[model samples]
Target: MKVLRNLIAIGLVFLVILSSGCSIKSTNENVPSSSNLTVKMLDVGQGDAFLIKTSQQVILLDTGDIDARDLLVNKLKAEGITKIDKLIITHPHADHLGGAMGVLMNFDVKSVYDNGQITTTSTYRKYIKKVTDSKIPYKQLLAGEHLEFGDGIKFIVYSPTKRMIDTEEDLNNNSIVGKLKYGDFSILFTGDSESAIEKELLNKYKDELKSTILKSPHHGSKTSSNNAYLKAISPECVLISVGAGNDYKHPHETTLNKYKKLNFKIYRTDFDGTVTITSDGHGYNVLKEKVQ
Candidate 1:
């Protein structure tokens, strides 16, 4: 009996150590919403930015590119967003986090969340300094975690697992991938994560990955949106945040063909100034600035 107890104690300790790497944390306070949830894929030339508005909070997903901070700020101001409740920077890539300083400089940010990746770029340095100097509450997001999105909507984070972030040098794959869940309506936000991470998510989440919509991975780049992974998510609609006449030629043809084959409704910020989706928990309606 003594031997069995010793072995059980050791196994329990091992399990605790294994699970401590990444955790699923939830806040005790939840402010349930009485209105619809809104997500806008703002058009920021040559980069990406998404604004999510719950009834009680406003969340900025990405900050576009370094050169396009004005456009990002102007667009937000045009939308009457004076303050941001949460700023979630997916990765430290130039295009994704370049305008982070602009956001920090222009708005009242309540808190910040990121994947805990680091880069030596000046833009990153400036952005981090601003966050630190401002004394904003900052937290690192990892797989298996949850963030409250206000009014019962929550973000179920699924990527940049501590193991992967430590082992994988690719910042794109380390991008934070999360699914915004609001009742029956949900959309997966892929922060430029590539095929390998998508496959990992497939194996981990499986059927749970199915979402009503997918914020097309990697801005519709061919390097992402793996066929098997797409089949697993089975998104009815795909939203791509790419810039017009981009040198990188994003929203590649191969990805479009795949979406077509699957008959998923497609919307792109390049064609549509800003694509917004409003969900009332049970259903959703998409509204865009213009038609292509």
Candidate 2:
């Protein structure tokens, strides 16, 4: 009888191991195939945060605000991001760079890129310290510089061709503008750039500014999306990052109407929560967070 009991116990152990193996296999099947590219626009409330994923690398655009630090870290973990190949801080505004210190402290970042703009804010100071302490390679992104993350994926800087010395203009005008091209699809990321900068970009890049998607400048501020810039880029879709009931009333009504008249599809963080766009180089699909 004792021998029979031992045999039954061994059979139970073997079954448990097989069940666990099946569970792990099922989980792995749900992850997207490595051949795809993903861009996630996080909803960080009044701030900006973006994650770009290629088969072999990960890139982070702004880090949102300090208040969203925990959320940002959790999101990265959820996406299985163990390391950041490149981190780009578009400008020095708190909303754009505040959470950067947390990200730098928590992840292994290989490199960082910025527009060389500075601000006296405490958040900005700490962010700089974090980057320096990590001993990561840092570069002042320049216009015409190309970033190659993997085969067929290219990111090109298009603004801040030269340092701005004017003390009168708002810092928003100094924001870095970049474009990402993956085969036939392209996206333009205009930091918090205003009208004056937009006019300059339109004058310089002209048709080169065209993209399939545009992260709307200045969170859809009326002063940023002038007709000339819109016509120059002629994006098929526009994304605006803003907080619900924000004090600035972001994504101004007039600006939203302008996009509507242009017949471009518009997505907003405030309304959509988080937006994820997946691309296969030639085509893409947009996914919105489901309301709870």
- lDDT against the true structure, each candidate: 0.88, 0.83
Best by TM-score: 1
Q: Rate residue 286 of model 2 by lDDT.
A: 75
1-292, model 1: which lDDT tens digit per residue?
Answer: 9999999999999999867733322211232343379888898976779999998999999899999998899999999999999999999998899888988989999999999887788988888888999999999999999999888999999988898778888999999999999998899999899998998899999988999899998888999999999999998889998888888889999999999999888888888778877777876777777644
> Every model's Cα RMSD, please?
19.4, 7.7
What is the per-residue lDDT of model 2 for residues 262-281, given as tens digits with 9 covering 90 to 100? 98888888987788887777
Count of steric clashes across candidates, in order = 2, 0
Q: Which clashing pairs does model 1 show?
A: 32-151, 33-151
Per-residue error (Å), model 2, residue 202: 0.8
